[model samples]
Each structure stands twice: as C-alpha cells, then as structure tokens.
Target: MKVSPDGQPTADVIARVKDIPLYREAVARGHFPVLEKAEIARGFPDNWMTPALAAALDAGEAEFVLSTGTNHARMQLIRPPYFLLKSYYRLWSTHPDIKETWEAGCRRVSLTTVLATEHVARVNAKKRGEEPRPDPRPADRRLDARTFYLNTRLDPALWERADVERMLAEMAEARQAHPQGWYHLDCSGYHLAHLLQKINKWGLWDAFSPPASIIHAYEFTPVNVRRYLQQHFACPIIDLFGSTELGYLFYSDRRGRYHPYLEDMSVELAPVTEGSGLFHLIVTSVRNPHMPLVRYRSGDCARTLDGTPDPAKIKQFSGREKELLESPSGPVAQGDLDALVGSVSPHVFVHQLRVLSPAEAVLAYTTFDGRPLAPRQVAALGHGVRELTGRRCVLDHRDHIAIGKSGKYAWLARDGK
Candidate 1:
C-alpha cells in the first residue's frame, strides 16, 4: 500500500491493508513486522519526516519553524499549516472554562527574549573587549520573520533582577494596551520558570497582568513549576508533546491529562518484566508517508493506570529508557524522584540526585544562584524524600548545578568510581 504525497493513504491502499494477512499475523504476535519492514525499506528516518511534512515544505505551506536537539540532536521542524495550528487555537478558545477567563477575539502578543543570538555574541564579545556586530537583515526577511533562534548558552548573571523587572514592565505595557489580549509565550520551560522565579523573588508579580494562558512547548516542565504557574495565574497551562520528526501528537486537557491526537497512530505497552506494570512504548504510526515508522521503540517508558491502551487512562509518561535506574530491588524512573523533590519544596530546583547508599542519597541543587536555602526548607526537602522513596536523602545547596552541555538537566546520577 502506498501513501499519497500529502500523507493521505489512498482508498486502495487502505482497503489493501484493511484485511492484509500480514497485518493480522503481526497483530496476533503483538508486533507489526510489516510496518518495521516498510521503515527499514525507507532507511528508518525519524517519525517526524512524514509525507505531509515533505509536501508542506515542497508547497511552502508551513508558517513557523522550530529547532530541537532534546533527543536525537539538533534538527528543524515546520509548524503545521495555519489551518492545522488553528485547530489547536480553536481547542483552546472554545474550551468551556478557559474561554470564560480568556478573551477569544484579541490578537496574541508574544513575549520572548530580545536579540536571542546576540545574547551569546555579547558574552563572547565581552571576553575580547569588543562590541558585538548588529545582526544583518536577511534578504528574505519574511521567511525569517517567525523564526526565533535562542542562544541557550547565555550566562545566568545577565538575567538579573533588573532584567526580570524590565520584562515584567513590558508585559504590563502589553496588557494595558490591550486589556482583553492574550499572551502566547514560547521558550524553554526551565528558562521561563527561572525568569519567573527572579520576578517573584524581586516582588514584581503584582506589577504585571497575569497571562490568560501559559503554553510551555519547548521542553519538559518540572511538575512543581507547572503547579506554581497554574496557581499564580489562575488560568489553564497547556503542554504540547511531540518531536520534530512527529508533529504535535498529544496535548494536555485543562485537567492536565494527555490525550493523543494522532488518529493513525496506535500505542502498545509491553511489560519490561512480568507483572512489573512498567512497559515500553511501542508505536505504529501511519501518519508519515515519506518515512513511516512501524512498531518503533520510542525509547520512553509508561504504565497504564488500568493496564489497558485506553488513552485517557495512561497515568504517566514515566521517563526516558536510558535514564531509568536499575537497582537491586527494581527499576526506578527519574520522573518519580523529580515529583518527590518538587513536592517537598517548590523552591528547590534539583539538577542531580546521587544515591550514596541503599538508604541514603545526596541532592545537589542551585537555589536561585547561590541564594541559600533556609535550613527548614532544606529539612523539608529531605523529609519529603524520605516520605516518598523511604530513602533518607541529605539536601545540599550548591552555588550552581551544572546543566549538561546539551542544555538538559539530568535528574539522577549513579555513584561511580
């Protein structure tokens, strides 16, 4: 069966696969070898390289482009055509509870870092005692209008209290200009939350208008920060889950439950061990025509709350396969520890958790750039870990918890020689 250039499978193709003996046989074996065969035939491009994506690029239908290196290294992805993104817009605008607080007709104002690339260049220029050159206007400015390239390597010292206050003032000005306006923020969750913490710590919250909705799309949001934003704004916080290779696949409802959006994608959970409940995510997606992926190992672990494939019942998108800690007792996901720490103290930003002994662990975290954690807060964090994991952990405040060169935080680290 062949897929169309636009990623739509033809009627003949659908009919052929509807009763194909190979598909039936594969399903019976709890696998999809035919899809794997097709992927292998196509050289197994990432799942995001679908036929629709190629068609969109070929026809110049994409609007915004985003780059992500979170998993398989840096690569660009085009946002779906306006019509497709509008579907997402509609979902938010028409949501019953959300629509009441957020005005539907107001145009969105995007608040992001200024001169994102120059931020890095300025840092480099300072070392050489030279001024950074102004960015040249591209010949095709329209093509670059919606493109935002953030230099993720900026020094934390630059984003001080004054810089945070200036951003809040801008947000306030935007709100005053359009009283009913909605804000559409785009940035890494960690960066945005860090900025907000500075604002709060500096007493700037009352000066700015609360955003109608907050969308954190670029990276995984630490659970505590999500709760804080929701509580502070009293508005819905939306999270988009997908990769550059795959278009947006899931979105959280107002209640923060993820619902799959891919009608052509099916998910299966194969237990890592008998009765473990933890399982590997096996996906068979027919969405990408140019490069289809069948029975693909997404390298993520999850467990169904009710032990079934009902999308609504999927309780947790646990952790990356490689990040799982295999101890003598069993496998423990990093996400579990993240939740435990966050629950203990919302102010704590744990960058690494090291197990020092079977019953003891050490937490290394940065308290807003050497701002010491109160003794009671540190104790509360330790107590929370003991309550959650039954492991007594010593909380240590550090000058800084190093982000990986890749700009990701590793939550857990095993003791090494």
Candidate 2:
C-alpha cells in the first residue's frame, strides 16, 4: 500500500493512518515528514488520537505510556497489549531457541535495569517537590515504592524475599491446576546480574528453580552483565532490541551477535554528520494498525561492521545520537566502549569511561561481587582505552556504577550526557 502524490495513502495505508487527525494535513498534502519526537510529543493525543485509537484504549485493546527519553516529559503512545508481550506473542515465543519456554507454558517474569526505578523515582519526586536520594549501595537494585516503567516490565527488585515467596505461591497454584515447573526470566542484563549478586549474597542459589530461558531487553546490556547471566543461569539468555514506539526489531543469539527480526518493517542506516561511520536508524514500520510510522528517525545510532551503511552489516545499535561523546578519535559510541570493556575482561560488571584530556582518561568500573581486577586486567583496560582514543588512562574502581538520573547506564559519559 502506498500514498499518492496528492498526499493520500492508497486505500490500504489510508485505512489505518489517514483518519488520524495529526496526519490529516500531511495525508492531504501527499507528504509525510519524518515523525520526530518533538513533533509527536507536541501534538500528542490530539494528532494520533484517532477515534479508532481512542476506542481501542477505552475498550482495553491498547495500552498508553510515555517515552522515558525525550527533552520534555515524554510523548504518550498507545500499543496493543503493550509492546513487550505483543512482540513475544508475535515473534520471540516462536523462535527456535525460545519455543521451549512457550511450549512449557512457563510463567514469564520481566526484569529491566535498576535504572528505571531510580530514574522514575527522581522524576516523580521532582513533580511532588520531593528530593530524591542516591542509592547508597552501588548495585542500584532497590526498587522505588512508586510504580514506574511501561506496562511491559516488572519491577527490577521483584525477586526480593516477599516477592519471591509470592511468586512461588502463584507457581504452586498454577502447578495444582497444571503441573509445570518451568518459567521464563525476562529482564535487563544488569538487573539479572544484580539479582544473581543478591542471590549469591543470600545463599539462595538452589532455593529457586532454573528458568527455561532469560529474555533481556529495554537497555543495552553491558558485556559483563551478559557474561554473568550466561555463566550463572543454566538456560538460554536471549537479548531483544526495540522501543515502546516500535515493536521488536532485533535480537541476539548466545554469542551476543544481533540479527534483525523485523516484520512488516524495514530499516536503513543514514550516515550521521557529527560522527564518521556512525548512522542514525531510519525505520519504516506498518506493523501497528493504529500508528504506521513510516521513515521515522528513531533517534538511535549505530555503526556498520564493514564501514558501509548497510543494515545487514550493522555492528551495534550503539546508543542515542544526543548522547554521542566527542572522542579524540572522532566520536565514541556506547557500543565502542562495550567492545573495549569486553576486551578487557568478562568480569568487569559495569564501567564508565570519561575522557579527561588528550593524554589522560579515567574509568569508573565494578567487577562481579566487588572482585578486584588483577593488575594485568587493569593494565589491559587502560591500554585498550589509550589505544582506541590515543590517550593514557587510569582506573577508578566504583563501589557501584552510578545510574543516570533517569536510571539509565551511559557507558560513554561526557559533559554530563
């Protein structure tokens, strides 16, 4: 289905996006400028809030939530069954490696980064004139009493004693109805690592059943966290990539290599002018019947493995363009740091590398359970940074890596990004 030059979608495309008030003028002009966050956030509820969409929300056909990353509060969007479950029921539950969890009829548990709770708390606190306090412990595993996150995720700290007991009780009830001990652990890589750290500390490793698999999404997983999850969990650890505005786009195999999983969607990488070899993700998705965003700039960036702007060769989804750091070697993306950290050691749980000057840098890092890196490992980490950025560096062992005010991890932090 296509739109005519007269600024109208063919009978098919129009059947979905046309009646939407926000696209009325664009649809009439036979033109659709890319959907920017600012524009969508500015015209929200009024623009895309078509009668159909409104009806869907009221009738429980769709769920509403705000984007966590935006200049303003956030753009609200509606989804059918929320994005996560929508993707799972639509794609992941059927993948070869993932089919077992589905066939077992396992209970699905989601875990996102501890950052979400921390960041959402700060935002909510500011709104209520409450001062947010920093989590004294570096793990950032504490959950905010107030609810945060889209309807898609469970709280990061949901595995606490009371919660775990409750979960077991529910599983017991389910077993009584139908015998099944299998379950799926869905979470962010760091939170899974955090949960494992907590379990080890509490000596509760064997108290719980092994999951059929661990599905991690939401934020980019640190190399160390991914390694830890795989080593500790005797199950498939799958990595999913996508956003609330869009459904699942990509996922990773056990080797941590990403492969596209687009359905009713296509993607292309356009060279970003600020950083050579870096490209902004351009996606055309018609998957959602209500909001068929076409040629939308997703605001995320990545690099090609072979220096070609080919989606087939995408090395990494990297990070947001606004967060790109000006490195002595052009601009450093988060994926660049992730690669560097992986080279240093799999035990490096969390790291934040800041460029201090052309000749010097500092890396704040944490290891699994506060395990100190050997002098050789520290030397290797410093050497990797110097080789990549042409700068000598020093290591700073953080008691815990600090989460952004928004409860996100910035592997490459610069100028307070």
Top candidate, metric TM-score:
2
Q: Estimate each model's TM-score.
A: 0.67, 0.77
lDDT of 2 by residue, 48-156 (tens): 7877788888898877666665322466776675455567555656766787767766555544644455555565566568676554221122223211232112343
Name the regions of candidate 2 deviating beyond 4 angstroms: 1-21, 24-32, 49-51, 54-63, 70-73, 81-83, 113-180, 355-360, 390-392, 415-417
The stretch of ten residues in a row with the least summed lDDT in candidate 2 is 144-153
How many pairs collide in each candidate, listed in order? 4, 5
Candidate 1: list runs displaced more than 4 Å. Answer: 1-31, 34-67, 74-158, 169-179, 287-289, 307-309, 355-361, 366-393, 414-417
lDDT for every model? 0.55, 0.67
Per-residue lDDT of 165 in model 2: 42
TM-score of 2: 0.77
Q: Write the per-residue lDDT of candidate 1 for residues 1-417, one digit (tens) a residue.
A: 233433334454444344433344443554344233233323223333445556666886643333344444343333544433344455556555455534544333333233344434564555569776564122111112222233323443247765566556655654565556555444456666666666766777787666666666555667765766665566667776654445455677767787766645656566756665667766655554333345556666776777664445666676776777664445667666676767666665545778777788788887533576788878887887666555678877786666554455667776781
